[model samples]
Target chain A: MTLRAASTAAADRARIRAGEHTGPTSGLAPGLAQANLVILPADESLDFPRFCVRNPKPCPLLEVTDTGSAHPDCVAADADLRTDLPRYRVFRDGRLVDEPTDIAQFWRSDLVAFLLGCSFTFEWALAAAGLPIAHQAQGVNVPMYVTNRRCISAGRFDGPLVVSMRPFAPDVISHVVDISARFPAMHGAPVHIGDPEEIGIDDLAAPDFGDAVVVGADEVPVFWACGVTPQAVAIQARPSLAIFHAPGHMFITDRHHDDFDTGESHDHP
Target chain B: MTLRAASTAAADRARIRAGEHTGPTSGLAPGLAQANLVILPADESLDFPRFCVRNPKPCPLLEVTDTGSAHPDCVAADADLRTDLPRYRVFRDGRLVDEPTDIAQFWRSDLVAFLLGCSFTFEWALAAAGLPIAHQAQGVNVPMYVTNRRCISAGRFDGPLVVSMRPFAPDVISHVVDISARFPAMHGAPVHIGDPEEIGIDDLAAPDFGDAVVVGADEVPVFWACGVTPQAVAIQARPSLAIFHAPGHMFITDRHHDDFDTGESHDHP
Candidate 1:
């Protein structure tokens, strides 16, 4: 089956909702926007929104569902949050408990779902523009790190900036920055282009999250703010209860990745 | 004294906070970022945020204070919403009733303040680039009109798009689009450059808000999404209570108007 037939975003959502498709969501919805999901209680919603505002590179918010309402009209028009995603990681008091294929058991009337822009949105843009992604080519998860720079604190949510790394040749780094910057809703521009140590990563080989891919002799490492930020911060805060998409198992929006493009006109706003 | 010296932004806020300056804030903060202010009860906050997300050009949100918080940390760290601005227009059930300089009397613990980017932020850039502003040149407010275009509605905040008009010579319309496009946090680019009737405005001589300016023979009238949208929509909803910066009065932010540039790398994203 072609990628399209093998991975239907709507179908996958249905299967996940039915407890059938319990695996990573990457590569499932080829052109659709797959998001990093963060579910938090209503009482602590203020801090999470502030955290995203202060660290937009990682937490470019796409749509914020109303408290106790599972639907985000803007991004995923009709999807149900409690059981639409393939998997969810539950956190209690900032500690991870169990990874569940569905979260209906954990659903609460006071939860607010946030759909954040993910790197995958820009990756598709880059690939279509003929930019090579080394990690994807190597079939490995993108490398991530905990940076030395602290995120601007918002109430109880505060932690080090988390970044995902992708290696590209010198000239290509600029191309990546130029392309990714256009998707401000999806982390916009690269936070740092070169010198990983500058941001406090001691070794690229030992990533804090995901698998590290090779950085070619002529290639430089490019970093974009990661969506894991709000999650990491939320988990750190140990809210009474929180839920997030398992890493790499994102929530798919009805919007095609390209549909998210406001084009040059969007750059104006 | 010239408007430049007399309109020192820092001093204007200082005097306003002290109850000495209680008039329009226009031209008072010269080169600083002045915002359109909207205060709504907490229950209505989500719809307004969605309104901004959908109609970004008219409502490029710069800062949204947490529900009930008087401080907008990103815009003005120490400014108090209750007393900083020169004037406030209070609406009860969507009808304007009181125009007060201080909102301390109406302050509520569940109020949410939204600061939207205003066109004034880009006016300084246009003049610096040698583009003439007909309204400013004539010592009048920018002419605005209600357009036929229906803004992408978010919940109960549905309304027609409102735009401000500026006449520019044919040769300079493209340049204006290019310069203003940089400040997305400010209404970035012209919504319509040449035709007035196309967007449903009947005459250039009459305006929905502010004063009309002369359109030279070689000039074309340009329309941009206006900040008046939120206030107009709010009044229509006639919420139990709403407060906004009176026309020509705005909340001055610490960010220089130029700091919110989004044009740097549009080609890639």
Candidate 2:
């Protein structure tokens, strides 16, 4: 199947819903908001949101669907979560069980869907400022590292913070932080910049997830909280069932990148 | 037996904890943050926070304590919910059954306490700007009304939006909105202004909660989302057990009014 970019989120979702589009949503619906999806049973609902609240940097909550409901109330009123995304990975007991285009077969009355802001929005902000994105340039996944920092635990959810790295010149690093920090709903600002070892990231050449990029001699690698943290933590809890959007496949919403902008420009952890 | 203001929030809570101060927290801990407390059983916990997330104007959730844990993790890490507040109201199936200074006996392992941002923060912001609050001037409660507009529901927790009225000159109404709008965590901006009838407020002389204040001949009434909203809505849910901070007996936190300030000056719903 060929990948295509649609002019609008509605168009993109419609194609994906009808099974005409089954590719990653990276460039589709260019300006509209894209979210990382996490569906869990109602029993685990409270602790999950609490986990997001406690570790906002890693998991900026966009909207949470009502228990057992596949339709979102805030992000997109009419959009159905079960079929809106291009792909979903179903996890059973922390292990990947299946990858499906539609989750209607697995929808349960006790399940709740949580939509979290993705780093894609802030990447637009950085790209708009002419800051080159390494992964995009290299045609590979953004390098992500599991850090030594443990997120504030809420009930059954607790794990090491995961951060994605991007190297930039020292002088432009402040500008990069300034641009990204304006969107808190997205992964805002860097967690560590100068020394990767401080955050337990021993080597930049090898990353736990995604492809690693070479750092220029004059550039320091900057890190931002990744959306993968919640998925990692949630799976670490070993819940009986969990569902996530496949890598690069996200839930598209009508909201745009500017919708997530915060007034504060201060770098957030 | 006497109500007195303290120099700081810690001092005020210390007195309350020791049973030395059992009065309204209005003037005590002047600059510190005061929150509206809501405790619900585990079954109702998921919907309650979802309700707040959906209706943030009236219920900006500051923190949600872990189930059965008296120690708050966010608003005040060491503060004990069972005894820190001056007073608490315990409800059974929506009926008020007990008013107590200490609720250690009622504490259950399944209870989850939610701390919501109170209007007291923005009232300070308004007062700091020399805005004369009508109720403060009249030495009466800030009049509140149940609005015609129902809030967006979040399974099992749905009710009308409640708003508190403050009369201000039309000339400075925009400024008032701008100032309070800077604190989205506090009920940011007015929901309705001018005649109250538009929002189902029929008589200005009578209010659903708090005492009524006379509107001036030259001033218009500005209605802000009130903290009473969550209490009214939560009780309406008829949860088997619910606990709240009694009127004027809020849970004081170490954070101050300035801490709630947002960069946005635009009025929010």
Candidate 2 — which residues are off by over 4 angstroms? A1-7, A124-141, A166-182, A187-194, A213-222, A257-259, A262-269, B1-9, B125-140, B167-182, B188-195, B203-205, B213-221, B256-269
Local lDDT at B259 for model 1: 56
Candidate 2 chain B has its poorest 10 consecutive residues by lDDT at B260-269
- How do the residues B189-250 of candidate 1 rate in per-residue lDDT, one tens digit apiece? 77888778899999889999999898999888988899998789877877889999989888
Please give the lDDT score at residue B18 for candidate 1: 93
TM-score of 2: 0.85
What clash pairs does model 2 have? none
Which numbered prediction scores highest in lDDT against the true structure? 2
Error of 2 at A34 (Å): 2.0
Tens digits of lDDT, candidate 1, A1-269? 23463257668788888888788887876788889899988876766766776666787777777678888766665689888888899998888888988888888898988888888889999999999988889998999999998987777888999999998888777678767766677877788878998999999999999998989998888888898888899899889899999999889887777554534432221
What DockQ would you assign to candidate 2?
0.20
C-alpha DockQ of every model: 0.23, 0.20
RMSD of 2: 6.1
Worst 10 residues of 2 chain A by lDDT: A260-269
